[model samples]
Target chain A: MGIPIYPVHLEDPKLQGFYDGLAAGELRITADTETGEWVWYPPEIVTGRPDATLEWRTVAPIGSAYTFTTVVRSLLPGDHKAEVPFTVVLFEPDEAPGVRIPGVLVDADGIEPACGMRLRLKPVRAGDHIIAGFAPAQ
Target chain B: MKAGGVAITGVGETPFIRGSDDTVLQMIARAGLDAIADAGLTPADIDGFVVNQYTGHGSDELAHVLGTGERRFAAVADSAGGTATTGHALMLAQLAIEAGLATHVLVPYAIRSTKPGGVYAFHANEPHKAAFEMPVGFFAQPTYFASMANRYAHEFGMTEEELAAVPMTYRAWAALTPGAQKREPMDLDTYRRSPMISTPLRVADCCLTTDGGGAYVVSAVERARDMPHPVVAVQGIGLAFNNWPHGVLFTQKPCTFEFPGEASAQRAYAMAQVGPDDLDLAQIYDGFSISALVQTEMLGLCERGQGPRFYAAGHGMPGGRMPINTSGGHMSGGYVPGINLLIEGVRQLRGQEGQRQVPDGGNSHATTILARN
Candidate 1:
C-alpha cells in the first residue's frame, strides 16, 4: 500500500534537517552539540535550557523496532482510503538508545513486526517525496 | 486543600447525540443553566467560574450567555483533554473556594466532535505530527493508542480476549444506563465483530464520537448541606506532569505505554488519607482501552500489568467489588472529555441513577473519589 500523502511542513527550520537527511539517504537526528545528548523531534528550545543549541548528526542506520502498529484505518485528514493496512514502526537506532524514529515498514516478505525486531533504514518514495521506510534487518 | 472543603452541589448534561445541532456554546449554556437550577439558584447566584479553554469560550462569554452575577473569582483551565476539564479544573475550583476567593464556581465543558472537521482533525494539524508522523501515516488517537497497546501487550502479555474485556466491562454497565449513548448489549463475539481501526484497537476500544456538554457547580461543603444533593465533597485531588507536551507525547516518551497516572494517584490518595482499598467506586478517563488498562493499574484497582485480567475476571463489571465508570464511561457512555464522567460520579453518589447506581455506594462517609490523569 502507498503511504498516506500529507505535506511535510519543511517550514519549521528544526524539522527540515530530518527531511534533508532523508534526501541524502542517511539517518540523522538532533542532538545537543555541547552535551552530545539526543533531543528528539528537534524542539525549538531545549526543555529547560533555552540557550542550548541543537545540531543534526548522522547515526547508524540499523536499529530495532521499539513499538509498532498495523493501521487498518487511515486517520489522515484527507481521503487516504487506499492507504489502509500499513504498519508504522517506531525504530530505535543502535546509536540512539532511547530515541525513536517513525517510519513505515517495507521489504518484509514474511517478516512480522514486533517490539525489538531488527530493522534498517530503507527510504521509499511516496506520492511526490520519499519518507523514512524500514526493512527487516539480517 | 482539606478534605470536604468543597463539594459538587449540582450536575447537568445535555443528551449525548450523534448529530445534534447544538453548538459548543449553546450546549454549555443549556447544561450550565440546568446545573444552576439544580442547585436551586439562578445564573445570577453564581459568582465564581472555572472555564475550560478547550471550549473556546471565555469566562466573559459564559457569564454573558448564562447571565450570572458578579464573578469575584474566575480562572481558566489552560490544559487539554481530561486533564484540563476534570483534574486541573477541579483543583483550581477547590483552591479558589478554599481561599475564599469565590463560592459557587461553575465549571462547564462541551464538545462538537461532529463539527466541520472530524475528531482526528486536531491531531492532523499538529506541527510536529504534520512534520514527523503524518508522512508515515501515524496520526489520530486510535493509531497512536494502537501503537501503545502493542507495546503494552508485548511487555505485560495481553491476549486479544483480555483486551476485549475492557470494553465489555463498560458496556455491561451501559446496558443499565438509560442515558448512555450506545446501550446495546456487547459480548466477546460482538466485540470481535467490531471493525478494527489499528492492530488490536477495534472501534469498541475507542471513545465514542459524542456531541454534548456537561457542567457542575462547586460550593463550599458547608454551603452544600442545604443544596439538593448529597455532599460529594472534594476529599482528595492530584495532578502531575513530566513536561510531556502533546507534540512528543505519542512518540518520544521513554515508555509511551506508561502514562503518569501513578504519580498523581499516589499524591491524591495521600491527601485524602486513603488507599485504593478504601475506594467504593471510581471513574477513570477511558480515552482508549490501552489507556484505561494502564490507568486501572495506576489507580490501584488491580496489580500493575494485570488490568486485562482484572477486567476479564469481571472485576469492574456491574456488582463487581470495584465499580468503575458506572455510567458506561466515554467508550460507551458520552465523550465530553472528563466532564461527563464527573457528572456520572456525582449522579451515582447522589443515589438517583435508578438501576445503574452501585449498591451501598459508599461508607456513608468520604471514601469515594474520581482519579484522573
Candidate 2:
C-alpha cells in the first residue's frame, strides 16, 4: 500500500508568504490589531472590532512540539508507500505568544511527544519538494 | 437598553435518527413548521433567519422552502467547532427585534447523516482556517479536543475508563430519552471495550452524526408574552474569542480542566446574572467525552481536574446537583448540527422533555446555561 497524498493550494498572500518563507527557511510573525494580539498563519483581522491592524515581522524558525499525534488513518488522495504511520504535530514557536503551527513529525518513533517537548525544524527535500518536520533537539 | 430583547417562544426538534432519506430542506421545513405551529404562528410571522455555516443546505433556500418572504435578517455563521451560534442567533434576533426590522426570527439547522465522512476538507476553505495549522491533521475539531484529552490524561493520571464514564453516563441519560439516537444502555465494561477512534477517545466517546433539525422562534419579550408558551427571556449573553499566536501553544500551561473554558463561562454567567448553581439544567456541547469534562470544569460545575471525580460521584446525572445534557447531548442524543443542544436546553426548561425531565418536576420556570467550544 502507498501513502495517501494530497496537495493544498495556498491562497492568502500572508499565508502564502509564511509557507513560502518556511520553504525558504524563515519565519514571519504578525500582530492582530482588532484583538491587539499577535498571531501566526496571519489572521485577516483581530476578530471583535473592525479597523484591526496587522504588522508582519520576520523571526527565527525555532519552536517546540506543544502536542502531537501519530495518525493511523489517511486524509490524502494517493498512496506514497514511503510514508506510513506518519505523525502530525502542533508546533509552538519559542519567541511568540499563542502561536502554534501544525506539521508532520519525522523520525518520531521510540519517543513519545509531550505537551512541551523541545523540538527543532528540519527541512527535507522529497523529490524536488521541500517539506518541514519536527526533530528532537540537537 | 432599547436595543431589543429576544425571548424564545417556540422550539422544535426532529426525532434524532441515524439517517434519513429526507433532504436538508425537508428537515429544515419540518422543524420550522413544527416550531411555527408550536408558537401558534405562521410563516408570515417570521421575517428573519439564522443558520449554521455549511449545514449541508442554504438558509435562503430553507426560508424559500418554508415559504418565508421578505426576510430582514438572513445569516450563516461559522464559529469553527465552537457552539457560538446559539448565542450569536440570540444576539441577532435581539438586534432585529430592537431595530423593528423583524418581530419574529427563526434559528434553524439541519444535518444529513448519510455522509459519514467529516467536513474537515471543506472547512479548509474557511477564511479563518489557519495556514500553519492546515498542514497538520488538526483539521478535524475532534482531533484538537482529543489532544487536550490526551494531555489531561497524561498530567492528572486519568484513565480511559474515567474518560469513558462521561459518555457512558450520557448514554444512560439518552436511554431514557425517546428522541435520542443511542437509547440503549452500556455498562462500564462495554464502554471501555469500545474501539478507539483516537487515543483516550473511543468510538463511543464521540457524538454520532445523524439526520436531524432544530428550530426556535424568538420574538420581543412583550410580544412573546402573548404567545402560547410562557416567554423564556434572554436575560444575558456574552461571547469571547481567544486568538493566541503559535508560541503560546508551547509555553501555555496544559488546560487541566481549569483555564481555557472559564473566560467564556464567566462572561455568560455574569451576563445572565446567574451562577452555575442557579442553572436548573445545562446543555453543554459534548462533541467528545473529554470536551464535556473540560466544559464541566469551565462552567464552574467542578474544580479543575476534578471532572472525573465529579462525574464518578453521579453529579452530572438527572436528579443530581447539575442535570446536564438532559437530551443525551451530542454523544447519545444524536448529533443535530450542535444547534439541537440549545433547543434541548430550552425544552428541558419548558418542562416539555418527557422521560428525561429534570427532577424539579420540570415546572419551576428554570434557567438553562448552554456552553460550547
For the candidates in turn, chain A alone yields TM-scores of: 0.95, 0.75
**Candidate 2: tens digits of C-alpha lDDT, residues A13-55:** 6556555665777666676745546655555554464566676
Off by over 4 Å in 2: A1-5, A12-39, A42-63, A75-84, A93-98, A123-130, B1-6, B51-63, B68-84, B98-100, B113-117, B126-136, B152-157, B221-226, B243-261, B361-373
Residue-level lDDT tens digits of model 1 in A18-118: 88888999999999988999999888789789999999999989999989998888878778888777889999999999898999999875777899999
Q: Which structure among the candidates has the greatest DockQ?
A: 1
In TM-score terms, candidate 2 sits at: 0.79
Local distance difference test values of all predictions, in order = 0.86, 0.66
- In order of appearance, the predictions have TM-scores of 0.97, 0.79
Summarize candidate 1's per-residue lDDT along B1-373 as a digit string, tens digits. 8866888888889999888998999999999999998888889889999998878899999999999999999999898778777778888899998898888999988999999878877776568888889889988899999999999988999999999998999999889998899999999899999999999899999999999999999898889888877787777777877788888899999999887788878878877777888887888889999899899999888899999899989998998988888889999998989888778877777788888878766521112253210
- Over the true interface, candidate 1 deviates by an RMSD, in Å, of 1.1
State which docking tier applies to candidate 1.
Answer: medium
Give the Å shift of residue B124 in candidate 1: 3.0
